[model samples]
Target chain A: MSLRIPSVLVSLVALGALAATPLAAEPKSRFKVGWSIYVGWMPWGYAADTGIVDRWAEKYGIAIEVTQFNDYIESINQYTAGAYDAVTLTNMDGLSIPAAGGVDTTAVIVGDFSAGNDAVILKDSTSLAEIAGRNVNLVEFSVSHYLLARALDSVGLSERDVRVINTADPDMAAAFQTRDVTAMVTWNPIVSEIAAMPGANLVFDSSDIPGEIIDLMVANTAVLADNPDFGKALAGIWYETAALMVADTPEGAAARAAMGAASGTDQAGYEAQLAATRLFADPAEAVAFTLSPDLGTTMDHIRTFLFDKGLLGAGAPSADVIGIELPGGAVMGDPANVKFRFDATYMQLAADGAL
Target chain B: MRLINRHPGRAARLFLGSLPFLILVVAYLVASAARLADNPGDKLLPALSSFAQAIETMALTPDRRTGAYLLWSDTWASLTRLWAGLGIATAITLVMGLAIGVLPVMRALLAPVVAFASMVPPLALLPILFIALGLGETSKIALIVIGVTPFLIRDLSLAAAALPREMIVKAETLSASTWLIALRVVLPQVMPRLLDSLRLQLGPAFLFLIAAEAISADSGLGYRIFLVRRYLSMDIIFPYVAWITLLAVAMDLGLGGLRRLMFPWWGLEGRR
Candidate 1:
């Protein structure tokens, strides 16, 4: 004789199983942030190493873990996948990948923009128009690609006018040395290395589109909403360390030295990269920049470029698919589907001495 | 091991054979649970649900940007390059290996050169290939062929050289031409070993394919892995790696099965 298990018993067991697993709750005390090696983000490493991060976290009654990823993309990926609470990313990448992938992210601190750091260099040609009909080697679908598109737009040309050869960033310098590769778009120190070569001309750079290519410390909007103090602590650490690094005092020099060592570059090399990067050294400046209308226009340009390149996801109907909320309730793209948000509240708190 | 091999029933034997795989699964689950207990947000050793979700997104959902299922597209791209590279390498190996092994002049001229070429790391020639061949499908395919062909040629040549002397002498005594002797005697003996050599080269072939695709390619399994890798989407990465392993294993099994079916007399002794 077989004992029969009733359907009611099965339902009860299923419900019990479902109830056994607890739902994810807010992380109250501990948080982790991931950063990559870049001149602008070096302050994070310095802050963590110098105990500034610990001090700020202690004030907030929390523990913050700062992890450095060797690969720039991996850090952003880790943050997007929820391994880290916050990550350093570019405006275009933040929009294209995470926001487009349906992760609600907020750019809390506008760390810096590529002023002259990203550039288009031509072999033996001093003009942007000379790039027409030439094979340009660059890391395709990267900021260098965006820079190329913008440079081409300035000359009243499009991607159709030139051939793009997708060369890796590491191989860009060497690829440009080849007689066949006439032009290249890359970032420092590759850009600097190539520009210094004989017959290499810097025809265009990110300075041409100031504030368009932004580097940011973005946090998951849900995480930021749940732990507002995390943002405050991060902002505090950023501004304090940034101000110290920018100053001419020995303390500032030491900070820069530490940052340089952390990023595998010398003091002069770090300084060179810094010279090309426009850091928002002051909290008020960062706050104001986030609040400005130019931020909207820059994001609009980025979204359009991303959509056109098919980097904004496969079925993105238009550039407006990923809504970006700026400071003061202004929104760009799809207002209903707002994923990327610029919350200057934390930066404002820092500026107003609230942190 | 002896106990499992001596098992009388097929079911019992199969169950015992799968014990190691079961052990691995249980071990992974234990480690994953421990990690999740400490930090729920850990990306390393992600939960099984996350892996399932990632697989669904990559394999089922059409990419919102390209309107293509990433997994299928990447598989097609990678498989196309792999087969093309392997096909070309096989043809070259068959001709070059046989000629070198058979003729004294060919062996003297080609053996040392092929041996030396195999010693140079294939990755070092990537830049030269890209520069000379351009960053097209040609360069990627060329890289795979270049990477695996030398090793395959050397193996095949050695296999061909090891052929019994009496067979060749008998064929010559029968007034068989050089071409007839090679086609009838050497070719039949070497073909099965060639399949074995091809199987051996699949791992290196995949390595070359991924390296080439990683450096430059619009789409491929390697390209997709590296692309989503920027986001540390382990869910997609783990499945992709698993899929690649599955594909490689399937290929190995298929080749082995074909060898058994086609060359019934060719046993373990026949394989070098």
Candidate 2:
């Protein structure tokens, strides 16, 4: 009956003297990617600014659109609800939302791990040990929270020894300035602003614990399965963009400035922010970062930290939740084969000057 | 003399004032041991000290030097957005209330819908409004209309219903038209009630305005709070909140004065 209706409509339309049309090219495969206004995810804004996103999308016969979010949590929330094809998220939120919600999602590319970006800012003369019993402001259960927890472990203190105030990110700098907070866990430019305040000092940062503040491009498990080629194309484009960023060129500077502007910072400010984030200049390095043997031990610490903080729900999540696997061949999760393959196969082709 | 006349409420005032002192004393005693053992001051004290320092640095710094738009921009931007939204809402309420209130059948049909709408929290509609209207002034105006029109409808209905039966009867006996009776009798009766209703909704409209402006807005007082929150700028947040509160209070006073001036016969309940 449905088939008959379309045929009848086609015949009726044909009678109306409109062109008995030749079939049209398929509509562009428009995909929306969401990212928060963070320095780590500057590449997303840069790709959009440099026209690399659209160029790559056109090459793959797809149209790519990017949406920048003000709040990291809301971006993850929107991503979890399948509002976007992919989203840039911290390793923790990536786990809490898409991973925990039973959505088979894969972290395709590792962007940059925080080095000195996430910091424990304090006022007056104080060591990390001296921060005991002080109220530390941070968005609870976020990567900065983990950074704070890790900072405490280095000083032989527990996060429990200090009061944790559930302050949002945008307010952290002001909190530090107000001196109402003894300490706060946050990222730049707020970090830079607070560090500039007289009597303010950075007690610790992600640089103190490398490879902890991981950023990734996460794809929905189902969409990835249906369009593996699009995944490969995205991986190619992301690495290409990263390569351009690290190289010395006018385009790179312009792209960096655009990212800085989007983040409400200047070129120098943006470069300063980038200096603190350990960006993978090459996709092979990113791939290596993903598969390190320490990934297990560190993620165990992360998972345990999350479970203790009540960010992870119910049971303890297994280490396999990270889902690290080689690209092309191996499939981990069922049906969609959720792959965290930061494999440089496509990126290597994009680099060495090949697409 | 007024103080003596209001002396019966003195016990409540004293209790309220003493409550903070009692809390402080208990808190201090508990923190004294920590202060002695750790040689650290109380958290609130440090928080306040830092806040004062931040205020002196940021708020005191000239706008040109600090690149701040100044506190005045917040007041002006927020007030302009709210006035525009309120203007649209008032238009909607006036039209809908007039149409629905005069006809008893229309009033009966809409009473349940308006009552149900009135029960809905305005903030809850923000996301749906955003989706439908795309996070612009339109959404804010739509929400304000949805938030306020129901009260106006209800008030106008009651005012129309309370019209003296003798006036209607005499109008009918004199072979007066419905339109003539409505303009001459029903409107004058409803005018005072409408003013009261508008005044009552002013506070709620302001509340929803601030909340809506807080979410996804780039400018306005609420946005100022959110923007400053990223830096934990509680000093700025608190001042902006206080400013909005003052604006709301002033609007209430102004509306009350206007109500008294416009409707001389209405007592404090309506005049306010």
Candidate 3:
């Protein structure tokens, strides 16, 4: 009996040692980022394709996994379902999906805002005002819809002034060919493709409404709270890439091609596309863009526009609902300044050109 | 009266009875015409027609994706997946139903749980299932079993309850074993009703099965419909839906025929 007891104790000790060994070992972050084939996410893809992802991830000592999704909604769905740690999303989609799905997330980095990459292509209509009482097709509640509403407001026309057709992005180009839709508000390469087609005129583009289209590299709130250092490192990598991209020299052209190849676009097309997107190379400028005094007003516009269009749920766009600041000076929030954390320490350091 | 009856033709009555159907067709055509008039370039009708044409085109082609050759196309792959899922679900339900049906105490304890599970909408658990089992065949099959087994158990329990207590008593009195009595007395009676219930469950089972296939699956009739929807090829989608409906009807007929063959002279009214 005495011998058996000692042997049992030894066995238990051995099992404990085995379990403790793994626990003490280094754990990989399994950093998962979700992306759709949008233009803004070209950097992440470029980083991966050019092996910059490895260097950044290694600098932070984590294993990063990138997943490409065909549709924006699917990426949001996966993010909501906890399949992704980070995602590329627009300001409104960030609010709609992660926030609405009850998962607190943080918008960490400001990607390029749309300049002329998005447009409302009209057939036989020269001006926005001429589109009144005509069918204007677009995916409902998408950025295009927001752009269209803003475009219409500029011309003093309401949504009721035109017939809104529920054509999704993949079908919008084809829908235009059918001649059923007189006008369509969409993003490129759909916009570029449609404009290339004979007789399709650009009624309005994102250039008309500056700073309204904000894209971001957003992280789940819990992940950001636990790893501010990692966030800083990732931000360092992004700003460095942006610096290379905006140079517009021989090196800049190479960087452009790297980004272009990731998105399956040609070098010339990529440069043209980049020209239409105003990127903030300076971290201070990016931070200002997020926390500008006009941000509150911009969010209010988004809220009122979405609410009137029956898109936003019944509630005011409360700041607290949009973002919460962490213990560290890291800012996490909704894109339009309603929900934001202003942790510029990492971005500030990166602006000094340090990784 | 005799002269009028002599002049009465079966053809005249048939023609008179068909008038309502003809009127319905005309009304449908008129409504469609009005819709066309409302929007000349509305492409919904032409899109639907093109989709139908696409399906007919694809069906006749011996191409790999979806052609007349079932072995060469997605038809075989999808059919195999569906049947494998169905077969596993049927096996699980049968075993569970038999276990509960054969035991009165188990029936009392588990019938309500099974009933509650069946009452829950299977589609509502889709996201949960996706998270748990992923977009794989396992989740899809698991859903089918969850949706199907309770009704089978309920019916089997009732069938078991209907079996007389006297038979077991008599068997015990004669020194015959419990197993012997159950096998001799209960088994024969339950088999007929079990087959009947199986036939009845075919409709709901197929409905839930198709719905499960529709959500997040990469390949199936549901996937095919959605893929064509992306391209606005409704012509193919329509014919595919029609073909699937016909396939389901054929299944129903086969099951009905099998039921008749097995339960000959049972005089089972309202079997469907």
What total of clashing residue pairs does each candidate reach?
A: 9, 19, 13
Residues B23-111 of candidate 2 have per-residue lDDT tens digits of 96565444333322321211111234444654554356545323564566667767887777677766766656665766777777877
lDDT of 1 by residue, B11-126 (tens): 88899899999996776676556555644544445679989877887899997656899899999999999999999999999899999988889999999999999998888998
DockQ of 1: 0.17
- TM-score of the A chain in candidate 3? 0.82
Cα misplacement distance, residue A127 of candidate 1 (Å)? 2.4
The CAPRI category of model 1 is incorrect
RMSD per candidate (Å) reads 8.5, 21.4, 24.0
Judged by lDDT, which candidate is best? 1
Best by DockQ: 1
Q: Which lDDT tens digits does candidate 3 get at residues B15-78?
A: 9889998995565345334433432221222334444445555555554322344222545545
DockQ of each: 0.17, 0.02, 0.02
Error of 2 at B202 (Å): 12
TM-score of 2: 0.53
lDDT, residue B203, candidate 2: 73
Q: How far in Å is the alpha carbon of A108 misplaced in model 2?
A: 1.1
